[model samples]
Target: MSDEEKTPEAPLAAEAKTDQVPSSPDSPVIASATTESERESLPDLPATESFSGSEPESEEADGAAILDETMSVRRLPRGLIAQILAPEDETPVWIDPKRLGRQSRRDFLLFGAATAVSAAGVWWLLPDGTKQQWLSPAAASRIDSIEARFGVTGQRRERFLGRVLTFDDDVAEALYSRNRRVRAYRPSDVTPLRNNYNGRTPTGGYLVSWKLTLSGLATGKETTLTAGDLSRFPVRDQVTRLCCVEGWSAVAFWSGIRFAELLRAYPPAPAARWAAIESAVNLDGAGQPDPYYVSIDLDTALHPQTLLATKQDNRPLSLAHGAPLRLVVPMKLGLKNIKAVTSIRYTADEPPDYWNERGYSKYDGL
Candidate 1:
């Protein structure tokens, strides 16, 4: 029984092996079963003609035409587009990334430079910032301490400033500075004192009896001149500015006689180096000869611009303006132009003046 079953199975296996045998190369089955490598080695099939019957113009032209027709443009997506559309009011039309980088860098540099310059300017203009250049904080503190301890008498500060002013004045005088002209204005431009006035009104009722005394002339004699006597001299007018140490200033038309004319009439002695003029009014109630006199250098007294004013703005002098007479010297500060004239004396020595003792500069030029 085992031999018969085995014989049947062997025959069936033999038939299966025969049926699996390869077909001939000439058969359709063998051609259909060809591998991709074998098919690739064979010649390619002819392409179908695109145009009906026309031949191409040239091989180069046909190749170019083919490339042109087949070329595909790859465009960026809508979301990837750069600056294009914009509102009309917008300043920048388009912002190029590369250009913006360069401009922003330049603008940053300019802004930084401007900020630095502004900071330096502010530092230079402020007193606290510039104080180091004038004096150290420690030195200034020491000066303040000395003033406080000395009870505000200004002795130390006055001495210090006096030395400073001496040096300053010496330099200024030696430099041959040109005299600054006072501004001129029409007589109508006289700004009335309205409300602002300086110093006190004249007391002792001397405005009525005030007379100008001229002494120590070339003749070594004394001469007293009244308002009528001064008016007899040649009358002149000058428009000059009166600048006060307190920082108020005004321009006025002053009608008067030039001191040069007066000096010519009553010449000064050759030995005289100074001219002292006294006022009839007392500034200090104590009457310590206070502001009673002001002395000018001989050169200043002889300056062409100096005046012995009898009138102001073409009108007779008012009581508040030293009624009878006032010395109007334009080249000097208003303080030096003694108001209420009582006496004029020439001396070889520097005459004592009211403010000079008060620690003010004698050469108070404009």
Candidate 2:
């Protein structure tokens, strides 16, 4: 296939524990955290760096007294709470007191009130003397007042808040190596999901007739390709894990042309900073108005491990696994590894993806 042959490559929560039992007589009970900006400013320690979790000799004597005073919880330094809650390996080297914002009495009171309200709701929902009502009238009334004040319906608020919350250390680590390979797996290790297909499944005959389309390249050119044309490029096979948001993962040997190679073969316009991948399946029947698609930054689209995957485990891709051609982006979450890809478009604007539109982050890396 040539530039003249237009083909679409179908492509592409945490809880706070307030256990304050001191470990040792000399150990401080409260440890603080730096602000997000301050943390950002510090250089990341080498993986070999280690801290014994011991205070400096100069501060050791005073640390215990400070610990006793802050152990009350009410007077606990806000930054200290975060350090106390974090696992030892993930904890910061040192907490900067200056980063702890001064919360006024009113702010403290409001937090206390919110905690009380939450406790009340939990208490009301528990069975008491066989009166297992889901919620007590008083609790429900208070909740309703809060909801009304926020002008948010219960379902909408829950879904929105759910997506916005995170406490996973792995997630934080993933950001640093968003474009680097993180895990590997053997062919047998690849998970075969019972219902991996996210949306519409392509027809059994689709692959035979499928054409890959490329448009909006830096060369001000367009191209269409057949499966054979893709094979003509250098092929790479990588053992990379696919981490899904649903909490399952599999390592599979994905074989295909590096996406970088594809881009080099069909350069996009210099102004293009984003690439959109569209699939053949359209479960919603929304048609052109709402075709299922996902977009990624050009840097990601060109990651060496990113592939126009055509095979899995040295065999042709199964239909359920985005047969024919699917995207393989090791650094990104599963949603961006679009299946049964049909077209690729380059643009200056960041194109939206199916999940991103709903609530997921645009950079669903790692």
Candidate 3:
């Protein structure tokens, strides 16, 4: 397919406890990001492109904290739709005309019941105006009040409110993370894979000898294995939607060894709460040198749908589609589903994210 037609892929996140918002190595950011301009001066990436998360951007006046998320959850194209559908995450799982009427009565009823419970649960937690239509306007009104008192207007006002509001939305997503598993589909249902990226794929020559390295194990030991070793582990195949923050999604069949198998082989330290997946040198949408990475909660990484994806459809992945090895986690947004994974490190705190530093949500679970 042509570049314009193919789905665009984005950046990922990953850093050790020393930092949660990983800045671009060569960015001209001020050391003390205490000032709003200093914080906003980060990457300022687009929404669909993670590897670089480009949502809200905020930080404490002290600059001693994670940059506040101002554009993530609230800024996604499907954020409103996800809220409108009244379900957990931004996936409008019900909007697939292709899957309509494909389920038996039992499955359909179960899905409906689950969605209802999720809606009620969130409603009870967030109330009517917090995240719904009333949110932005209400926030605007409050910002107006602050402006009258402090003469704040234009971008400053937006930064303040954007940070506050997106933070609210991010909290809601992280809190319940409803245990609703996305529906799996048959191979026949697979659609053409869609991906867009500013970075070039790792050369096919390197992938021919690529191997996944596992470290930061709870055991405090590290090991490396070749593709042949991974093949020995039990494999999982599922067709699921890869949802993008820009609001497009596509169904694709992914085949790979379950992450659980790898965990069993290399258990994380009890203190390790996040898995910081690192990748080769790549470029961000801005064409900056982006050592693309992302750190996901161990819980999210261990979800059954998550995979150390080695194949898309029935064949080996093309370089354009993250050849050799990539992450395929259906529950998280596409950005979190990192491509071209080179190493996996377990960290005590959330690792710095490429996009989080660039002004997107730190926890962009779908």
Candidate 4:
């Protein structure tokens, strides 16, 4: 049969009515058409595109119009919007190697400079010479006043240079009556003469002989001590311990005239600040004046305990110890109390002390 003849004819009125009406209770119902305004108010259905190669031009135009409308509705470009919403990628900033190294070097240099300045300041503040602290200002001034009124300046340089002014021990023995006394020995009947003759001056009254020349005193001429002058000064006795810097100690009974009394006999200049004591022995053996000199302030010189001892242990001093006149400073160490004193000088400046020159403490006092 032909294709046109095989096609079914249109249904009769009854068959069409039956098809339009619901055949069963589970059948879906179809909406009836309304007015044009009502149809316009209904929600628009989504447009569809055909996948067939021969698409209608109107359909393509409609699709392009929709895409343009959607693009216009966006507030920003798609790429910009995506970037704003995307997670951030972070990178670390690196420090310059050169800059770090420079900072380190600067810190090191600053530290070193500070240390050097501190060291220099300490060195500058240290004391230069051996002037004792107690003899510094007020004490020295008092001594100067006494020296200026009564003390005479002597030849101090020769004493440091080791010039020995010798005297006979027999004279010292005759002066000290105890030297002639004999001690009885229980083992033998022989009585031995109490002679301690080591050239050390025993503790007793003895005259200290030294050439004193004062430029400002007595018309600037040399003044000599007369025998009568020795007789005028009264003698006193004292017992003191002599402590040497070398760690030796000895107790000796010293007999001498007070240094203050002797100073009153001859006066020094008013400008005198320190009293220098010089020993006859050049302890350093440098042919220079005895290096064993001590510079005392005026107050220490005038102290009641200061003496020019001529005897020791109730006998005339031996030569090995300081004979004749030796300085006895009770408050000071034995080294400061110079032995064999040959001269005394009063000066404004501090004099060189013996042990201080040998790296010992200058303030060697009790």
Q: lDDT of each prediction vs. the true structure? A: 0.63, 0.64, 0.66, 0.50
> Which of the two, 2 or 3, has more TM-score?
2
| lDDT for position 315 in model 1 | 88
Query: Which digits, one per residue and each the tens of the lDDT, describe model 1 over residues 314-364?
Result: 888776776677888777777887777888999999888877777677667
TM-score attained by model 2: 0.57
Q: What tens-digit string does per-residue lDDT give for candidate 3 at 1-366?
A: 654345332111111111322443422343344333333323332222223432333222223234433223333233446536653344222223333333234356878999976754443334234544655867745644554455544455446655875786577466634366777888888777676676655456667667778888877888788888888888788899898877888888999988877888789988998999877645566655568888788887777788988888879877788777889988877888888787898999989887777766766777
Writing each residue's lDDT as its tens digit, candidate 4 over 113-134 gives 9897675444333332212264
Query: Which has the higher lDDT value, candidate number 1 or candidate number 4?
Result: 1
Tell me the lDDT of model 1 at 144. 46
Please state the error at residue 314 of candidate 3 in Å: 0.8
Q: Give per-model TM-scores.
A: 0.54, 0.57, 0.55, 0.41
Off by over 4 Å in 3: 1-179, 284-289
Model 1's TM-score against the true structure: 0.54
Rank by TM-score (best first): 2, 3, 1, 4
Best by lDDT: 3
lDDT of 3 at 214: 81
Worst 10 residues of 4 by lDDT: 44-53
Compared with the true structure, the alpha-carbon lDDT of candidate 2 equals 0.64
